[model samples]
Target: MPDNDSIDPTEVARPSSSRRDPEWLRARLDDWLPTVTGSPATITRLEIPSANGMSSETIVLDAAWEDTDHRLVVRVAPTPDSDPVFPTYDLDRQFRLIEHVASTTDVPLPTLYWSEPDPRPLGAPFFLMGRVDGVIPPDVMPYTFGSWLTEVSDDDRRTVAGTTIETLAMIHSAPVPEELLDLPGPGETPLRAHVRRLREFYAWASQGRAGSPLIERGFSWVDEHLPVESDPVLTWGDARIGNIIYQDLSPVAILDWEMAAHGPRELDVAWLIFLHRFFQDLAEMAGLPGLPEFLRRDDVADAYARSSGHEPRDLDFYITYAALIHAVVMYRIQSRAIHFGQAEEPVDTDDMILHRATLEAMLAGAYWAGVR
Candidate 1:
């Protein structure tokens, strides 16, 4: 089986289980590529990798069609058999959002080719896009944990962080096409929409077992300190440096819009800041040298403000929300681990929230001072 090289930064470090049946995929692409692309479609190289993305599966393939050879990527929705992390997998919405954002903003992204809703051909609804070559900052080992990103100069690191925030500003301030309203709009109250989605995810992730009391506390905090209403715009939900594909020291394409939404500007800003902090804290615990100064909360907020001309607000609330969102994701990862028989259920589920100390400090208002 051929494989596409990728980075899976899982906290638990599970064995690779993503499908890599290249012969099967070759046959499928051989037959299906022509319908979308023109005739003379030939699958030159196909790699159905099992090493990246714990949530959805990505297929990398090169095809020749109509006197042109092209490199492309296919994204498939998570199947029920895979214990998908998020409750929903809207590939069409993801495709449309990428298309919509690319047309209006300067943000770099893959070019779309086709979207398939039927599962009979590949056993999943998938979409195809031109492949953009770059490196993904690893989550498991972490770029801060001695990767190429960490090896770069401090000035280069700062540029990577700065441009990412600038690019995010580009996304937030761009006028979302009215045609996109036909697709998901992140609901009337985007923040509450996020909370409700989280609640649904919590119920699915619990899987008839007990839920996280700490998560409950996190939700309570969110309710108590909900930020004032402001103008909503299209937000890149998974806004973090790790999600950016970097060529040399600059970001080329910002991937992973699975969590994209229309929400307050600060939501994406806080997620970017807090996610870097998340990795930095992990490196500290592991006695590693994470990029502690690269994406500081204050720095990114200021960058967003300066770049987008919109005032950054409620950062404390949103960074804490970012932590909660990540905690929910970690719980889902643990649930998948259990479902895959990776580890036995532990007595204390609180231990599942690896950043319990960080969340507690945030809840107590002691965490922001240290990071800022």
Candidate 2:
């Protein structure tokens, strides 16, 4: 094994943007290969760039062994004292569920390699997976709307959008593993559970700071409009365009299953739409087609309905809930960044400002929509 005595867990850190390590992850691969294959392998390279403002450090690994080369991803858990977003996450369960979902449905995810559930070797729970090749669009859709419009023709963009909807449909269509997920017993609704969880999260955030009163109001709003509970689906905890890897304007692999759980179908759909705010830069905010012009809000929902055999007529309700969820997460992160000494003060700018002038617009929207 490599020299563990010299390795400092703090040294391998993630930036506020992309929290991934490109260095020394090979050491982890070296340690894991022996356990899986009964022989050590040579690691050539590892590269894990930080993702946009998301927690957790993700790295990529390239290894050579037995005269063959392999590419994979090593998702290292953040130090407990450093990233306190979610104290405990079941990465091994996540790995197994990904494999299960991949086998049962058409949802695309990275192939699995191994999962290190214990923190002994790497200092925290981490997992390795086959590296997928694709392009993740910049937060604001780096390509100009017109260029994105012209380069990938409208028809192709629609196909991609339709594919996204269909992929989600497949996920919603999959049968939930009753034994695996410790969901409440039959006839026991989960709305109260969701509410209790969110309340606890808000309480955690409000510990030493003045949290947005809007959160409590949002909770009330959700309580008032709770949908009639239906069968649960595999809710990709952080499902959004940014989490998807696209190839040739089409989604190829879905990433980030840490928060995967059995929840309302609208939760996934809401998150997918609310996270759209992250992709709107200034020009796009001013009506320029920031994303592919082919993806209308209705088109996605309609496609999902047609493919999943379920109609989502109350999309507005879900959208508002999505906005509230983003708002809560952003507020919590502001507190976390302050606690970590990364930011001098806590400020909620309605999903992190893309431009300076629209602070009021964003906040007002988040406050009313998220909390309403």
Candidate 3:
């Protein structure tokens, strides 16, 4: 960690204007590793994935210090050179939430070792967690297109899906300690609070470009359809089997807390369902199989009910809200690709966002008219 007096969490930290040159990146890591290990540390292996995560920078490494070896993963806030995916990056909050959840409940998570807010160590605030060996579904090729899950039998698929739901149930059962981490304010339900933050995020992401009318429509529809009540519990914001690390067909570590928050249990439930749908939709567009039958909505809902003893409710509202949030995220991500010179400008701003028809049908009530 950098010296506490040198950095403030609120003051923005930016990386170099261009991606750090190879030599600079290597030298910085060489200098930073020793400070982390309490002695001179030698890197045995290091990898920073090339895939776009739209959240934080993930660094996976193996190192040796003082005759002790360790495998660690560090998640760092983006530098200015690497424009961030969100309006804010609070590594401290994420670290505390994981610690609290790991100690308070049975939810599986990577064992967190250190959280250093001082950016001097690596030019950005970050936390290090022990890396458990497991196979994570790949986002680059996309697990839905072809992966271990596709090769497995339906029985194995059901077992994995059910275990993931049970894990979510355990996470939702965790106690909410507002003092340790941020929570929704008075009079606002968790879902509404989340929506408010997302609106602010859209505003930030929309600057210097023609904003999407679809996003605006989504915001309006979501505001009018707020649920009557929502249970405030820990929500795994990016809940999906893809985020889980599996070994021997069981989740060894539940990863990704950048979107973690206190919200209705239904928020995570809806996300787990809708994220898969988003990918399934992508596969359909390409004319490929995408796990259409596995992780069925009814099966997920039933599994949650049996495990948690509280039936999920108002999924129509929550799932649509999840899609709305995801669409806005897609717009921002497209803008990012433009900034980094990956994709050509689209004819219409809405073209940047995926699943437009699904979002429209959701608002018309046709998407879940009979189900919800």
TM-score of 3: 0.90
What does candidate 2's lDDT look like per residue over 190-241, in tens digits?
5456556667777776776676756666677777777776566767767776
List runs of model 3 lying over 4 Å from the truth: 1-26, 368-372
In candidate 3, what are the lDDT values of residues 264-353, reduced to their tens digit?
889999999887776666555556767887777888899999999989888888889998988888788777777776655678787776
In order, the Cα lDDT scores of the candidates are 0.77, 0.62, 0.77
**Distance from true location, Cα of 153 in model 3, Å:** 0.7
Cα deviation of 284, candidate 3, in Å: 1.4
lDDT per residue for candidate 1 within 1-372, as digits (tens), equals: 001122124546643554547788788778887777667688888886544356778788888888888998889887766667777788878888888888887888888888898877787789988898888788767666888788888898888877787888888867855455323334447677767677778878886887788888998998898888467788788988767788876778888888887667788888988878877777766666677788877778787788888878888898999999988888777777777787566677756776767887898898866653
- On TM-score, the candidate that comes out on top is 1
lDDT over C-alpha atoms for residue 87 of model 1 = 74
Summed backbone clashes in each candidate are: 1, 3, 2
